[model samples]
Target: MSAATLRAAIAAPAPAWGLSAAQIGRAATLALHDELALAPKPGLVSFVDSGSHDDMDAHTFMRSLFSLRRYFVRMAELGAAQVPFAELERSGIAAEARMLAATGGINTHRGAIFVLGLLCAATGAAQALDGRRDADAVREHLRRHWGGALDARSQRAPTLPGGIAARRHGLRSASQEAALGFPVLFETALPAWDDARRRGLSAQQVRLDCFFSILAVLDDSNLAHRGGLEGLHFARRAARAFIEQGGAGQPGAPAAAWSLHRDFVARHLSPGGCADLLAAACFLRRVAREP
Candidate 1:
């Protein structure tokens, strides 16, 4: 479908007022920015620290995020049109090029570009159809529309390190996760965030709880790539321990989280995949809050 057709379809009458594609796209972008700005991210880049990645800092992430603004908008537009999966793949490739250029050939936010871009599109598609805008509905739209395509894409030979690592380690690739409608995001990360909020936890505490929840469960290839099976196991155990100890609800949780962060940095392990899911959780939470 053409972009104009998508815009027109999206402009059609819908239920109670909701965010437009542009607004959804912008919210997705800001969600990513918020994730980056979140400090003490446990070996992940934030506004105050570099985490485990010396190659990319918070400034580098900002540039990558800025470069992706139009890409997210276009992805949302494509979904609004209900375009073919091939078209979305083509757009993603182009956006990756822009991301690489913006980051001066570095791979900052590549995973996020894929995951969050799909979400932006799925959200737009749902809204265009006047469907529900909650997390389950958006994810259902993704599965109903693109599950097969995503599965087929996952079957293709590996290209990037994350994909290669996933294949070599028998972990799920990002495409597979998308094909499954992002079970980790829907079942794990979002619930963890919501549970923390329901418990009246602080924002940082909520994020901590959510991140650890993701870490304990997500088969993060970056962690595998950096520290192999041993590193992945260690990270999961640490996160699991944190969660069992009442997480952020515990009085000493912040200190424990900091200790885990230091350990991750020392081992050069970064749960980048989990970090992406955390950002996605934020995006979905924002989408759900809209009228």
Candidate 2:
């Protein structure tokens, strides 16, 4: 879809989904904030530092988030109306433009805009269908409604840096992951988060553990783009070692994570894909808990 078409869609009257759209949008925004506030996230931006990215910071992220707030709300409205995938794709493209403008052309939350945007849309669609807002329902609705589109999108030629890196290295691109209903977010990250919470870890620890769990397995294109396949494998190994040592439940776990963060920064390796999935997991968890 063209930018002009997206503007036309924005100008049109949006269907009312009551407070549901607003609520889902807020959840998506908060989920990004949740990811941002997490400190010592290896090779990712946090409130304390810019991680591997010297070009952007927490302030940049906040600006991007502010610009995207309404985008997510509109996505929810579209999902509730069961608009076609092309409409949602255009909305996301528009949101990405707003984010880049907000950050002076920096790409802070493009992945979040794509991942969380879809989840927010799915959440709205699920609610509209049967008032089901659980993670499973959201995933099911996303696949049922948009899975074909995502799968088709996955076959397109590489454009973004991440997609280019994925193709170059034979790694699964984000679109492929999405078409598979985000198996890493749904199967891996969320389960790791649940286990951490079940073990009575602190909120920060739970998130940190979940982050590491995702880094351990995700074929993060950001890592591949920055540090090549070697760097990606090194990051996965480091993350697996962290988990093998009892994760965030062990003493000095925070310190360990900090140490890994330093190493990742030194290596200039950023697991941005993992970070996006972590935010998605956080969004799902929040949505599930919302009344």
Candidate 3:
């Protein structure tokens, strides 16, 4: 590393975090690549953070960026597949609570969104351009269909109509969804979810409908971002600072975290979740693995 690079790294606001836009771009690449399993194990990528465990902002921002990208990938993949969600599930993943147990606590909504969005994006629903631009269309296809089911009252105390919201003992207060006895894999950042009972939808229907709106909003936001994509430049020195000072590569410290991240992409980061992680991982892997 050059003296200038070191100086810049030292001067960065979030020196511990490796989240400059350029690095983010790199993250997007890795997230996409990893999602596709094209070039796996991209190695340790870094971002700046306060080392605080209180919030999901760090991961959330990254996931949002990546997920949006993956959404497009999902659309592309769907164009080639001739099956339903059940068929997709037959060869795909169902959450393994034990496997995720090691992660301790995390903002599941943010983290899961990152993972799920990537998988979804990879499946060919990415960009959502084909979904028809009008929100009413999405509402017709996604809203009224499932949202109405989330309003039923359940006997469980901490429950919604079709699902229950509970704070997992050892984990961060992340919401889980189960329908007809199976846990579903998607989540949304929507706020009204807490009032599903009043909304006239069952927990199962609420879960599905929430995902629909989440995807639609994410897609719309992502398309706007993409319009300015090429013009978004990464400052060379800023890029260098992020990569060098990022806490992720401080010697052998990140092996476990890196391992988990690699595993995470494999297990989660599905059609709707991991585009950002894949792209980021790919970019970092390319940069690191290069001679």
Candidate 4:
């Protein structure tokens, strides 16, 4: 063998544990892809349907994904550097601007940029330390390290639509979810995903189950914002009924879900908060798969 070939053979193996910034970013991107690919999601844009959105489609989401990939990596790097919450938010703001520009000023993945960005940072911080990449470890680190700052952010006066709607409707805002270290993402959505997997559900079926489960409980401000209190309640009831019927795993569940999707479109309702939680669940599932 040549000298170079011999050196290549003797190179040290990469660590089996801990994710680098690039890995974290890639995982986040893949999670976004997974969310976008899940079809027949009620009132949410997917590869196969626009679902109550006229400004965007699967292509728009793809562009946003391309724009935000490096942002997730940068956030992960910042986490490894132990930056403050303000710094993270600043980075996220810049990333959101890029996303908007890429999608021609239409809001696509705005919620994901916020929630998933923090998750990327938290994952980096967890893995950067003793390589403890578990979901509980990352969540604990997030709450222990930045919980105060997040709670403070939640107290700020409402500016965005989701926040305004949440305040008016007395529902928990996305900022509050971040402040509370995303209890629904970790405690609710992730477990539901795992349960669906264990029960031998298909990929699409698992995502549908997870989405309906989140919708049943989440006071989705987007639904309130678009459809009012009556619309929100109606959405929750519909989701609860679907989940009660064994979600997409039961016979005829997919057809029922499609019917509900059409109803949501007809009513101009969107469970955007539940969609964000689903993205977070996908991200956490990727992180959990490392071990």
Candidate 5:
């Protein structure tokens, strides 16, 4: 479908959301500015869109995957420093890491952004790109971590459901090898499925490809999980107020100034729904724009 058509179709059904897609769009735009030297934190809950023609391009898909992987690593790093040694609960980073580890091991096939980033970076599409500093570095880093490269790991193969998503789409994970199966259902799995369906690739593929494809984004770590936890030394009681408050509206409606994040989604986000980060901003945009 054409880009314009794609936009309309995505906008339909829920022209009104709980927040501004533009707010998250701003975050994405800011990330592209490249000033932060950190991965972009567009803050859209789910960005992978399988139903939208514009978003299904392999390149765009790869970048979105890459972006999420980078963010996961960055969040882990940032939260780690916040961890307080004096008290086990003091460090935000440590606590988050621990939580992730407890929930699922970090750097594991399911828990690792490194594995996903490495896969995208290694792809022919990624290699063909001109300015892929992040991709390039990630590939090299994965190589060092794994006998000079990241490949499928037979040990952590996804379950029947997880395997179906990656297998159906011919998707490969950097950390996972065809030899070993990916074992568990990673958190990023669900979001990946929604993105694929939204992008319209659902028909072409089956089984969700949650292990490595855009579906893998659910594995992409964020501060919200840790932020939601209690006993954080700093930024405690966030209430996840940032995302929760986001509201939505119908097309052409007047947006109230609920929050800045709303506008951020409208301008930058595509119709990723709640499976991606744009959902948060879009919710806000809809809230502000709606009467």
Candidate 6:
């Protein structure tokens, strides 16, 4: 689909699932806000501070989210109509352009735009199929509908910094991760989120635990891009150690996370891929909770 066609689609009347699309879009934006508000996210930007990043901060993220609001709604509409993956990709490209424009060329939510956009599309498609908005249904629809295209996309040579780093280090790129249906998001982060809630942890603690769980396991090409193999290994080890010590549920967990945050800042390492997954997980959680 051409960019002009996508723009016209956006300006067109709402689809059958228009209300649901709007809700899905709001959920995605709120999930990003949830991520941004959470503090001491090691090597990530938040309301508390711009951990390890000097170029962008909470305000920049807010702007990116604002720019992406309509994009998510449009993606949902496209998915409900069962448009081709190319359409979704075009929407994402347009959203990324808007995000860059909003952030003044800073890449605040590029990864989120791709990751959460797919999830939103999947959710819309799933709802249109049977009114089932659960995570399993959404994921199944995503893979069933667009998995082949994603795999093909993963095979293409990448020019982005994170993709280049992944290729150089022999790690999975974001495209590769999405091609596999986002195993870290569906398997690791989502389960960790549920487990934390089952353990009666606070909302913040659940997010923290889920975030660390993703950091522990994901190849995190962003971390590799920023800190190399050594930096990535250090981050995985630190996250593992945090989980071993009872995660965010344990005593003094916040203090421990703060200490790790400082260490990550000192090393200039940012697990941006993990952060995006965390936000995706948050979106799934929100959608699942809705009737």
Q: Rate the local accuracy (lDDT) of all candidates.
A: 0.86, 0.89, 0.29, 0.85, 0.27, 0.90
**Model 3 lDDT per residue over 165-245, tens place:** 122121111122211110122223233233343556654333323322232223211112222211111111222232344
Report the number of the highest-lDDT candidate.
Answer: 6
Native-to-model Cα distance after best TM-score fit, residue 259 in candidate 2, in Å: 0.4
Question: Can you write out model 2's per-residue Cα lDDT over 1-291, one digit (the tens) per residue?
Answer: 455654554454434532377788999899999999998999889999999998999999999989999988888877776778998999999999999999999999889999999998898778777678888999999998999999999999989999999999999999999999999999999899999999999998999999999999998999999999999999999999999999988889989999999999999988899889989998899888876
Residue by residue across 174-287, what tens digits does model 5's lDDT show? 235311212222223334434545655532221212222222122221222222112111111121322133211122111221222243233332112112322222222222
Backbone clashes, candidate 4: 0
- In candidate 4 the C-alpha lDDT for residue 203 amounts to 83
Q: Candidate 6, residues 30-132: lDDT per residue as tens digits?
A: 9999989888899999988999999998999988889999998888878776678988999999999999999999999889999999999998888777677
- The numbered model that scores best in TM-score is 1
* Pairs with steric clashes in candidate 2: none
Task: State every prediction's TM-score relative to the real structure.
Answer: 0.95, 0.94, 0.25, 0.93, 0.23, 0.94
Model 3 RMSD vs true structure: 21.8
lDDT of 1 at 70: 87
The segments of candidate 3 whose C-alpha lies over 4 angstroms from its true place after superposition are: 1-72, 79-82, 87-131, 142-163, 166-291
Candidate 4 wrongly placed segments (more than 4 Å): 1-16
The C-alpha stretches of model 1 lying farther than 4 A from their native spots are 2-7, 10-16
What ordering of candidates by TM-score runs from best to worst?
1, 6, 2, 4, 3, 5
Q: On a 0 to 1 TM-score scale, where does candidate 2 land against the true structure? A: 0.94
- lDDT for residue 171 in candidate 2, whole number 0-100: 98
Better of 1 and 3 by lDDT: 1
Better of 3 and 6 by TM-score: 6
Candidate 2 residues lying further than 4 Å off, grouped into runs, are 1-19
Clashing pairs in 6: none
Q: Is candidate 5 or candidate 6 better by TM-score?
A: 6
